[model samples]
Target: MAPNDSAQTTEEAKDLVAGRRRATRYIVPVAVAGVAAATIGLVPALAASGDPDLPKITAQELIEKMAASDTQQLSGTVKINTDLGIPSLGGLAELGGGSLAPGGERGESGSAASPDGKLLELASGSHTLRVAADGPDKQKVSILEDTAEYSVIHNSGEVWAYDSASNEAFHAKDDGSGTGPGKEREAAPKDLPTTPKELADEALKAADETTSVTVGGTAQVAGRDAYQLVIKPKQSGSTVGSIKIAVDAKNGVPLKFTLTPSSGGKAAIDAGFTKVDFSKPAASTFDFTPPKGAKVTEADELEKEKGLERGAKNHEDFKGMEDFQGLNIIGEGWTSIAKIEMPGGEGIGAPKDGEVPPEAEKFLNALGDQVDGKFGSGTVFKTRLVNALMTDDGKVYVGAVTKDALVKAANEGK
Candidate 1:
């Protein structure tokens, strides 16, 4: 099932966080960055070596070259393998979030390509088969799983994702939406981290030392010739200074990429292009139709709601029964100030205050003393605290903060 599926979101989040505790998701991200860096930096050196005649190509050029072949409608199969590393779940783990594990099993289907260079087809997975498109960036792929599940219309910078399961569609400016119609390309760092080539350029520029060598070998897959290219990292502390990619010598596409981490781990990713059909794909592949009575919501609003829901769920999961039981009400006609005060005198949670309330400060200080310092490392006084305190006083605060100080202040009843 997809990670976003209702039943799996919680469990997936759990497993993902656990995976991070193992190696911290750095393996794949760094590897990706390293691959680009290594290629960008090492390719030149390789070209400079005895094989001086090999044409000079920029990292971007290489990517374009791989993507450039036969722009006029071509079809093939794609087998994508990604080995990613997740970080520890210390506070940042959930904050940094995690990546979706590439669905297991190879995809098989008759695919087609369009004149505009779009590849569309139905993919067969172990459980559910998804049909999607490889948008302009290739990485900007979209899942066209159920035409009936979502009503997507792209026009004048508007985009929507209507879910058939819940009967609600999320809306956001097309700029943030990938693929789909009228969506603007997002900027980098913010955009899905740059492609491998961009990372390669960055790595090459920053590399302190460079060397060139041609490790010989070639293999044929999908009727394409692939070459083995290896480049080593220069810095001792670098996560991955070395990378190897099996590039399709004939088509300029990559079939395999190997990353060696500085921490002594090995990861190999294989991408297979199968069922190649160069015929022009259908024109309706990009079209989408909405479902009936779907609730429409802006993307940011959905995100805000998701965050709030997650936070509330987290509070229920972590907050002790004693927390709610201990507090009582006071005040005649006064409304309640529900704030999430952490253990330390740090930040407050929900119902953000333009100015810190006196009770919030006291609550944070009092809570701070209890945890002593289990929240985080630099978090000796810091702790994850949610304060939803109500009193006769007109004050409130919520969210992450230092628990110790809050505890201290609350106990003194200051």
Candidate 2:
């Protein structure tokens, strides 16, 4: 074979591997995010006009109801829309042979792309999710795109993830022990704030002198009666306006969540169920078998051991980090800020000596404004809903408020 041809083949192989990894990263979070949203009964629909005659409830009463909400067998379809205002990386789909393209998994390689392709689909537009829960431990979530579908089924201690586009599947068995490959099998980070109830709980925990909670009113979502709970940050520097959650009137489950920035024209992130059914999904829904000729990866005992070791090391490393010591919350509730002292070039994938990679610097410059302050030179990345400030001095401040809030937090050094 010609040398040039060999080089091209090698490059192509690298791209394929990278594409697979990207797809896994993108698809898993989305599916798990769907489950988190679904677990809280966050099915989306346009909020119905307010009902003045509905019984008005206090904020404390609403919190109690949410705490006591029933979560059992249920199924629903959710719609997720996110507009982060980040420019799309041009030709990402083409570079990966349309593997990241939305709708109909057809790619230049004549194969269905992985569910990660749906990331491109959701980045700019809307997507549909179907979720069902049999109990706390049994659940299924499926993401349906125009031409591709990704489904995860967990039942009877077995978990299976199938991608229709790639004709591939992954299987893992939970041996009732929480420590193993089954532990690493989770696609989404357990710490992500995905659900309305979870988000509300976090906010409530942070609510202090700087925040307030109020009952926003009553409305209907997905044909079910719901009461609106609103959380607002009192700090003037906060860029956040308020967060609103629609709680199911009957069960106290949250049906929808919306985050609106203080200077906001629109909700930056809107996720919820578009439709829902209280009826339990059939048992067959969780049943899955790998299709003929599909690639399969199973998590055996050895693999489980390796996963356990990696998790242990990761946990230990996190605990051993001292750079973040003395970190404190700057504000409370929706606009709260958290600042951490980072060692120069020590963050994940960070370049040495506090140097920013050219590509990343360019991207950050485009997305935010550069500034110098007592904390050091840094860039403040701002979006409709969140803001982050990273300094060359190895400090990081982030908040769901606005750029000003992040800046304030950065200036008030620990």
Estimated TM-score for each candidate:
0.36, 0.66
Q: How does candidate 2 score on lDDT? A: 0.69
RMSD of 2: 19.5
- Model 1: weakest 10-residue lDDT segment is 109-118
User: Count of backbone clashes for each model?
Assistant: 57, 7
1-414: candidate 1 lDDT, tens digit per residue:
885587788888898889887676678798999999999999967653442224444444454445444343444555543332322222332232322111111111100111011111111121111223343322112333344332343433545444454565555565534444324433433465656566555555554244232333554445555565655643222234346665556566565555544344434233455334344545454444444665555666544654665677667756643343232332111111123334333323222344568796665455433232222212112211223322223222222222333333333343
- Compared with the true structure, what per-residue lDDT tens digits does model 2 show for residues 1-414? 466798888988899999999889998889999999886664332234545356878787788788656567789998877766644432446554433443233423222323344456566546688999876567888889669888877886787778887786767786753344335534343656445566557657667467788998887777788888987877776766778998888888788887776787877667787787877788888888889998765646424544564577768777757655646677665667777665544563223343777786676577768787666677777766567787765667877766656766777763
Instruction: Give Cα distance to truth, residue 315, candidate 2, Å.
Output: 14
The alpha-carbon lDDT assigned to residue 274 of candidate 2 equals 77
